[model samples]
Target: MPANFTIVTLGVADLDRSARFYRDLGWEQRGDQAEGITWFRTSGSWVGLYGYDALAEDAATEPVPADELPTYRGVTLALNLASEAAVDLAFARVQEVGGTIVKPAARTDWGGYSGYFADPDGHLWEIAHNPYWTVVDGRVDIGAT
Candidate 1:
């Protein structure tokens, strides 16, 4: 079977809060929204948010421990921009939309410009512009060799 990714879902404490955070980040919701879930369109795949307990129950698993709140250990939601200038622009837009900067945008040793931020629920996100990458028709095709 060929492998493909269709949706990226995040387990959130509050679906409406996560949805508002994404909306503040300029994402538009798609289709119908359930009581504890929200969906947004992205470049290649759709993004979704569902209440943490709800998601766990749906998967037939116990809810993760409350102490493990936010749950982002080494994971980051990354966005790739078309140009270095676009990187600056996107970072500014993120700030304007209620995201808190974890790191200022700067050139990296890997030859890219990037920065980090957190959503309202403290989920980490990275906005980056890699000189060696490209986005065509809103799809990110990695070229950083």
Candidate 2:
């Protein structure tokens, strides 16, 4: 299998609210966005927003109430930064756009800096800066030293 991700579609409760949140984060929807689904292009992939119930139905699964979701979902999307200061700035931006800060940025036991925030639909986002990693053009990877 190829080690690449094409897109991540998040099921949101309120389409407009979720859309507005992303827009407030300096992202613009793609030019060919269609009705019912909103698409935004990131540095290396596309992000999609669709109605939560509808998305669940499409997958042939019953929708779970947002409030009932587990505190720690099995997956978390991350935004890696080049430095601790950058991570701090990104967290600040998230707060400015009404994202819920699960935890404030702090030094990690692994010698990195990180924090967590949740979107309106309670999607987890990690903003972090790993001194041992190389972050270039929105992509994060470890360089051979």
Candidate 3:
């Protein structure tokens, strides 16, 4: 199989609400109507928002109840910025959109600055500035700095 990472779809409780949250972050959806799902284009991948239980059904897996979903889902999506100031700005934008600040932006022991936040459905997003990596045009390239 080719090593191409193309899409990241998030299963959300209320599709419209999730769409709005992302849209508030300045992301434009593919279509005007979400019907039951929506898609937003990103620098390296496409982000999809679909119904929580419906997504599980499509994957032939049992769906976790919304109330029972754990705070940390064992996975996190990251937005790597070009500078420390950019990371700070991202955290501020997240808060402006009502995202829960899981970890306030601060200097990390790894010699970078980072912080975490949770969306309405408890999906964790890390906003970070990794000095070891190069971020050009909003995409991270390893070992290129």
User: Which lDDT tens digits does candidate 2 get at residues 24-136?
Assistant: 98886874435888998888898999999989999999988877997578999888999999998888899999999998999999999999999998999999999999889
lDDT for each residue of candidate 1 in 2-103, tens digit (9 for 90 to 100): 678888777777677778878877887986666557789997788888777877888999975655665366789888888889889988887888878999
Q: Which 10-residue window of candidate 3 scores lowest in summed lDDT?
A: 28-37
Better of 1 and 2 by lDDT: 2
Query: Residue-pair clashes per candidate, as listed?
Result: 0, 0, 0
- Report RMSD (Å) for each prediction in the order shown: 2.3, 1.7, 1.6
- In candidate 1 the C-alpha lDDT for residue 114 amounts to 94
**What is the lDDT ranking, best to worst?**
3, 2, 1
Model 3 residue pairs with clashes: none
Structural similarity to truth (TM-score) of each candidate: 0.85, 0.92, 0.95
Question: How many angstroms is residue 109 displaced in model 2 relative to the true structure, after the best TM-score fit?
Answer: 0.7
lDDT of each: 0.81, 0.90, 0.90
- In candidate 2, which residue pairs clash? none
lDDT by residue (tens digit), candidate 3, 1-145: 9999998989999988898899999887896544787899989789999999999999999997999988888999999999999988888889999999999989999999999999989999999999999999888888633
